[model samples]
Target chain A: GESVGLHLPTLSVQEGDNSIINCAYSNSASDYFIWYKQESGKGPQFIIDIRSNMDKRQGQRVTVLLNKTVKHLSLQIAATQPGDSAVYFCAENIKGNQGAQKLVFGQGTRLTINP
Target chain B: AAGVIQSPRHLIKEKRETATLKCYPIPRHDTVYWYQQGPGQDPQFLISFYEKMQSDKGSIPDRFSAQQFSDYHSELNMSSLELGDSALYFCASSPVLASTDTQYFGPGTRLTVL
Candidate 1:
């Protein structure tokens, strides 16, 4: 079965510095990728997403870069804040055996912000 | 502006017992999905309902079953719960008619099996 995975299990960064979370997917046919933020005791929240047709997409303070050749994806957060402290997960939208929307998620990267 | 709603903030059951979790999708949303998050792990897809039908099911065991009602409300039933069944369950909804991939999730239900 296809799976999505992250390189780092945890990342620590200064409050004012940038943070990068990396993810890799095994399915080359995946057409869409999304980043989600999960706070303690809460469900995953949609952050940003990019389609395979595009290489990069940007949100308010978040950017997603996708590399098709390497099946690597990254989420970059600018000026990391305390509120940004959470578990980050990347999911890939791929076709299912029954022809449905299937999202394969990575293990996740826990981001910790230092004062 | 109603969002996804899940019932039973927390639940505890003994081994071999059955547990049922519920979810109410945002009104008018055509798609509903269920996910499970084990301790120290990311959310994993369990099953999904769209257009009042079973759309997808992940690699979960057969003991896990789900149903979507005409009102767009969904329920996940886990029979013969085991210790490994302990996890956080989330419900989500999105517009199926649109190509948008944005999914809004509920607060989530924490299940603990003894």
Candidate 2:
């Protein structure tokens, strides 16, 4: 979608349409990546994930693409629905001390589905 | 499909007071993570535990500390609460066997510090 999606802030798409959200990361060592959706006043819900070795992965209506060359990640949602409106965040798994796994989350992009 | 559970969905405290937040992770999950989300801001990682041991630390303040028990449940204890501490706290759990460590989040606890 342009570049490693840096906090687009907001994206509006018509119902039944498709929209793409992008995220960029500087760490090439981050092997695992995840996409989470968070609604108002709610915790983040896992949507999909892709590893550094893979370029694309799909789940339900969501597709996550990883471009290791550019350290870019994008989530494509097909057939946007009303219930899909929420803040989307991209997180990369960066290992800490002793086999520890913690996610480094990017600033989210608020997606609004218009009817 | 059991999801993570967070206690006291909401909490209110006065400045300099103490607060305790608890999290019950999904069955068999070995890792628990905590995050803080300020109003209109993205979630920030606080800390994480693996197999009841401290695994990683993030931007958690000195007054905030957390631990995971043998049962895999975790608690976050905060002292000297400040108004700036008011925010949404989220807990996520993941099974160690999963290669991706896909975390499942529980409904957040909204804490208000007066």
Candidate 3:
């Protein structure tokens, strides 16, 4: 089965620096991607999303880049802050065997902000 | 803005026992999705409903069943639970169920099966 995965399991960034989280998908049929931030014991919070047709999309301080040729996706956070620490997951939208749309989430990258 | 609501933030169940999880979608939202995340694992899609109808199903065990009511609130019923069933179950809702619609998640219900 095609899966979504992360390139790293953990990441540490100094306060005020930038952080980048990477993810890859095995299914080329995936057409939509989203980044979510999960705090300890909390549900995932939507960060940003991009369609396969888009190469890049920008949010408040986040940017999502999509590379179709490599089946790679990245989320970049600018001026990282302490509150930015969390487990980040990248997900892809795919039609399941039953034709229902669902999200395939990555293994998750834990981001730590060092002050 | 109002977001998805899940009841009983924490639940403890014994093996072979049954558990029911409820989710209230954001007002006026018509689509609901359920996912399960084991410790240290990414969330796995369970099932979904659109307009009180089954829209999709994924990796859900036969012992598990779900339904979306007319109000768009949903419930997941798990029976004959095993110790391995302990995990965080999240419910997400979107105004619509589309390949590109953004789904907002609730606080999640943490189930601990002993």
Candidate 4:
């Protein structure tokens, strides 16, 4: 079975510094990608998403870059803050019949903001 | 500004007991998805429903079943629960008809099988 994975299990960054999290996926057929942030004891919150047609997308203070050739994805957060500390996951959207899409999440990376 | 809602913030059950979880999606969202997350693990897709019908299936076990209602809410039923079934269950929703719809997740229900 194809899987999505993160290169780093944990990441530490100083407050106000920029942070980057990387992910690798095995399925080339994946057409959409998303980044989610999960705080402790809560469900995942949608951060941003990009379709295969676009290589990069930007949200407020956050950017997601997708490299189709390498099957790689990365999330960059600017001005890291304590509230930004959480488990981040990258997900691939596998299209299904009738325009349905199923999300496959990768092993998450725990981001820590060092105040 | 409404978000997905789930019932029974927490549940405790013994082995072989049955458990039922409910989900209320955001208003006007027609598609619902269920996921399970073990400790320190990423969320795993279980199943999904679109317009009160099963839309997709994932690693859901035979002991579990789910359905979307006419009102667009969904429920997950687990029978003969085992200790390993303990985890955080999350429900998400999206409007499949939209071109750029994104799945928004609920706060989740914590199920503890004793």
Candidate 5:
């Protein structure tokens, strides 16, 4: 089955440094992509999203780069903070029956920040 | 800003017992989605509803069923629960607009089946 996947299972970065998380997806029909952050025992929180028509999107110290040709996506966080440490997941929105949009999430990457 | 709300933040159920989880979407949001996340795993889509209609289905088990009420709140009912049914259930809601496909997730309900 077509699925979304992450390049690394875990990442470690120092505070004040930049961090990058990568994801790869197989379904070309996907039109929307999003990044989510989940802390321990909590639901995923929306970080940022990018449409397939666009190549890049930016939000509060975060940048999402999408490469349609390779079906790759990356999330970059600036000045990594301790609170930023969590499991990060990337999801692709694919059209389901009846024009419904379904989100397929990738295996998350655990982001660890060191003070 | 309003956010998705989920009831019974935590629940403990015995094997073969039944459990119900409720979700209240943000105001004016007509679409609702349900997902289950196990320990150290990503969220898996269960089912979704659009305007009180069953819109899509995923890896949901036969023992589990869900529906959206007229008021737009959704409920997930699990019967004959098993230990594997213990997980974090998350509810998300979005508007019909395509320009904003971002789904807002609720805090989620933690279910423990013994």
Candidate 6:
């Protein structure tokens, strides 16, 4: 389950509903992780990030939960909106010696918000 | 500051042809990285450059190579391309060498192999 989670490639949710997207990482050594959103015909846009030292981090209407024991990462969006419809991806970083910019990514999950 | 920029926003090539993609890191940034994104998939690391040299390369084939110039710009070269090489290539830049350093990504170059 190392790959990014997208149980449903396209999730249809009524506007204002909460959204939860999951990701599984294989590298337990990954000390840092980030979530990115990519709209159609565009590159990924940075969202929020969480460090291994912490279990959860919250941003404006977004929360990232990290479970080290299960090697799971999840992004929870509160009050989903149409603009939230995009492909979301989670990336892991292992800072052994290669450095910080070398990140491994998981498969993207396409999220759709219904009107 | 302006974000990362990539050249040849779209490219089309035939099998056995060679393709070169260029990237310009963000202003004042020193680290550059290249990643490949297949349809409906996340971006995968291809290679990284720091201090104007190759620092790390993923499981990409030998035909796929990269070079850095003056520690600010980088190029990814694919020689003898195959149909399977078609994918959206992205360039990312980060300021320092810290694990928590945030990475900024370029729009990406869509490569189509015919």
Q: Which candidate is the best by DockQ?
A: 3
Supply DockQ values for each candidate.
0.59, 0.63, 0.70, 0.65, 0.64, 0.68
Better of 2 and 3 by lDDT: 3
Instruction: Report how far residue A13 has shifted in candidate 5, in Å.
Output: 0.4
Ten contiguous residues minimizing lDDT sum, candidate 4 chain B:
B95-104
Candidate 5: residue B21 lDDT (0-100): 100
Candidate 5, CAPRI quality class derived from DockQ: medium
Clashing pairs in 3: none
**On a 0 to 1 TM-score scale, where does candidate 5 land against the true structure?**
0.97
TM-score of each: 0.95, 0.95, 0.97, 0.97, 0.97, 0.93
For residues A1-115, what per-residue lDDT tens digits would candidate 3 score against the true structure? 7799999999999999999999999999889999999999999999999999999999998999999999999999999999999999999888754456789899999999999
lDDT digits (tens) for residues B30-81 of candidate 4: 9999999999999999998989989888899999999999999999999999
lDDT of 6 by residue, B33-114 (tens): 8999888777888888887877777767899989989858999999999998899999999887778887889999999999
User: How much lDDT does candidate 4 score?
Assistant: 0.93
For candidate 6 chain A, the 10 contiguous residues with the lowest summed lDDT are A1-10
For each prediction in turn, the share of the native Cα contacts (below 8 Å between chains A and B) that it retains comes to 0.55, 0.58, 0.72, 0.57, 0.58, 0.75
The all-Cα superposition gives candidate 5 an RMSD in Å to the true structure of 1.1
> In model 1 chain A, where is the ten-residue run with the lowest total lDDT?
A94-103
Report lDDT per candidate.
0.89, 0.90, 0.94, 0.93, 0.94, 0.86
Docking category of candidate 1: medium
Q: Which regions of candidate 2 are displaced past 4 Å?
A: A1-5, B97-99
Q: For residues A1-115, what per-residue lDDT tens digits would candidate 5 score against the true structure?
A: 6799999999999999999999999998788899999999888899999998899999999999999999999999999999999999999987888788778899999999999
